[model samples]
Target: MIEPRLIDTGTARLRVMVEGAGPLVLMIHGYPEGWYSWRHQFAPLVAAGYTAAALDVRGYGGSDRPDAIEFYDMAAMVADVIGVADALQPDAPVILVGHDWGAPIVWYSALTHPARVAAVAGLSVPFTGVPTRPLGDIFRRAFTDRGRFFYQEWFRAPGPAEEEAERDVRGYLRRLYYAISGDAPPGSWPEKPAGATLLDGLVDPDPFPAWLTDGDLDHMVAELERSGFRGPLNRYRNHERDYAWAQAWQGQRIGQPALFIAGTRDPAAFGFGAYSDPLTVMRPHVPLVEGHMLDGCGHWTQEERPAEINRLLLDWLARPPLRL
Candidate 1:
């Protein structure tokens, strides 16, 4: 791995880990995860002759964390992506790959600044185009209003979620990670009654899955402990704002080569009854696209199945649409 550094993106300074040197491939990680989440991909990406850079998404790890909730909005996040690309390779566009919240971040980066992003790919979450309404509202109707627990709804508030997670960072990470992973037993993430905290129904599996090592958990725990859950949880607080800002491109489509990957067992991949298939849901928004669903794979796509994810990514990068 190459040395990590912080790049000033005007709005904030983002910590980035970079490796190799060729056509740039910028990776963005999802909630409760830092650039370290993409640790499995850098070596393979470098070996395949592509410069790989993964960033902390402005809030987690070594990146600057803004106090205001609005600072973590979609527009600001997109700017960070462009800023990183410009800092790394000002002369050419870069490829983007994201997981979970990172998925939407990269999708919007390509949509809002097509000139800077040559192609885009997402894991665990598919591009659904510009939002007509906030997902929080949808979750409210589906889960909250019906007296069910929705993690995002719990995260929508400011202090409570942070306190709960921060009180026991390792325990929180352990339970959350295990609960959503494919390794968890069936019915691990069952719907809880309303008023339940994010950690209420989660399980802390003993002898944690082979995919996530003790070293990995220690690294993640250390970062979250230093940064606190405020910035990471703040990402969920901007759903309403994100929906409103996305209106500028209400009808816009990401007219770039795209790829998507997800675990078959991943709850986020099911689209919450909005769509049954990710490929079908993403096709309209991303015309030139390809997708793969790893059997029994969970939210941690690349980490859970690094070999398969690497093969899919390298194969996609080698395709005709994106020869770089």
Candidate 2:
């Protein structure tokens, strides 16, 4: 069982779920997910002889939610990671594992504060080094410029997406989660013109996939209901600001041992990543990098394939660079 505690990051208080005791491995969840997203890996990580700490990122779950959009920027989030690590294990640099938006967060943490992060692994998203342009501009040029629908563009504004998501949190979560999962058919995400909203054409599966149970959906919905969507959606609104802040480190590489995992079917792995070859794009920045693309897997890497991810993680953790 995992023990829950609140970690004071000085800037924000994050609710973290921890298990076992050894070298610390801090896991950060992405958008719309809490510490519970990493629940499947805790036991296996502990059995492999490591302390597994999964945190609900600021603004999600019980974590502190700051009001300003700028508070959720990449720099601020990286500070939270460092503060949490400082509190959890002061003597040694800690391992960091993140997924989705959490992927970029951990990537920036390692990039900006190399001495604080020993090794980093990201699921579903790969680190392609510091950005030269804002992500919003990239997506707009690719999608909105061509009159196509991109979810991030829909999420660019704060109000409408929140209303749609908060109006029926359960339904919104079900569709949002299912549409991008492995179980969904190709194009299950739906095709729409640029004018459409994010949830305009998505469908909720009659019976949700086994990986995400009814109880799981219930827990996620309940969390969102309490926290609201402003803090989470605000993350998307900061692309230009994040890009500006990252310019100082424009040509820098991670300079750490790194691992990347993604599903063949996951759009984020390819579409959003804007590359057919992830390792190629990642290697220049993360020289000592290892990657795996799970067959038929989707966005929710650990959740959908816990056993596989656990084995891979254990094997990687035991590698010479990361081995204690």
Residues 131-159, candidate 1, lDDT per residue (tens digit)? Answer: 78898888899888999888888998899
Q: How many residue-pair clashes does candidate 2 contain?
A: 0
- Per-model TM-score on C-alpha atoms: 0.98, 0.98
Candidate 2 overall Cα lDDT vs. reference?
0.91
Per-residue lDDT over 20-111 for candidate 2, one digit per residue giving the tens place of the 0 to 100 score: 99999999999888889998999989998899999999999999998899999998899999998998899999999999999999999999
In order, the Cα lDDT scores of the candidates are 0.91, 0.91
Which residue pairs come into collision in candidate 1? none
Estimate the TM-score for candidate 2.
0.98
